[model samples]
Target: MSRKRGKSGRRAAPRRSQASTRRSPVGANAAPAGRAANRSRILLMIVGAAVLLTGAVAYRVFAGTSPATSSSATLLASTAGQAQGETVDGISCQTSEQVVYHIHAELMVFVAGESRVIPEGIGIVGCFYWLHSHTRDGIIHIESPVDRIYSLGNYFDIWKQPLSTTQVGPATGAVNAYVNGVRFSGDPRSIPLTPHAIIQLNVSSEVPAHTFTFPPGL
Candidate 1:
């Protein structure tokens, strides 16, 4: 068929279809859209990886099972010296000299109107010091070649636990140390480990224990 012509006798150009118009621009712009989508996917992957790593770290910390922590605990325990149902540090408490002096002391703890049992192993570790405890009965045995002043804090240090004016283990609050049936008005840590000394560390109890009877032969 003959093409239509304008009045100047030139043929008119073919008009573009709606589908072609839509597709041409979309195709031209496709590269940027694809690049944006890829960037978004990479960002999402990075975020997910970071979240997973953080959660793993948090779990390890919460569980107290981190390698560093475990290794440190093992090192400390080994250093503290534990063997044959006994724990002691590198320091040697045993001496070839005869026991020139011997003394006994008692320890008692009260928490919230309840008697807390002191464990048997105070001063047994890191070289049972010149002073030691054999039983939970709170009898601290000061057996040494020479008599020397020792403090309740010294014993606790060998035991490796927190004992201060404000706290004892899980118990928190004011603490009082009584010696020989009298309330000691100084730092509980400073209570002297005198012979036949009756030391009572009371937590949250203002009134000290009246008496701590020593066992026979203590």
Candidate 2:
């Protein structure tokens, strides 16, 4: 009983100090309202920055285009008719044992039942033949005959890079076909073309079909 009585009065000392307490470091002297608000805003800014960075990294990983894998043009439809109108009248394809040919001479005439031509001296690789006097109208041609497997070489001054295929067979029947490092925009449709294949006259031109030449001995 005597110890209990002494403990109560000692605790009473804290009550007296509370009755006359002074300002303290974490109380009245604590950070101002403006300073506290600034701290909160800085924390929010840091969180937002982290979220934005994460989104950017995810986009790069999933949506980026690789030079070798990405194609500049779209996949053309199955046949050349899309170039003209509603029928096979506008486009045509001719195949030789060794080469595939497309002639864009005149689509209107083709629609009217006409054909385009192929030129000669075209089998040699790196040969440049100007089909039209107009450069824009000229046919950009390329060919490759394999003395060995997997040896492809192209020299088109138009494109600064050599981005095409040099395969023997048709390109797995896929659109946007490539052969011998040559890129062609057509339906996977091609000639009955094969290795060392030769044709008498095959001159392909994008000029109007009536005007395209089918020069002899292609």
Best by lDDT: 1
- The root-mean-square deviation over C-alpha atoms between each candidate and the true structure, in angstroms, is 17.6, 19.2
- List model 1 lDDT by residue over 1-218, tens digit each: 99999999999989998777675777788999999999999999999999999999975664342122222221111114223223233323553322667788877666665665555555554355566667545577777666576677766666556678987655777988778877789778788888788777778866545565454565
Q: How would you encode candidate 2's per-residue C-alpha lDDT over 1-218 as one tens digit per residue? A: 33333555653332457536666756664568668899999999999999999989964543232111122322211222111211121112223222333222210101111121212222222322221111121232322222222111211112211223222121121113333334434322232233322211111222221122222332
For model 2, state the Cα shift of residue 146 in Å.
48
Worst 10 residues of 2 by lDDT: 105-114
What's the TM-score of every candidate structure? 0.53, 0.23
**Where does candidate 2 stray beyond 4 Å?**
1-20, 24-37, 66-218
Which pairs, if any, clash in model 1? 87-125, 88-125, 88-126, 89-126
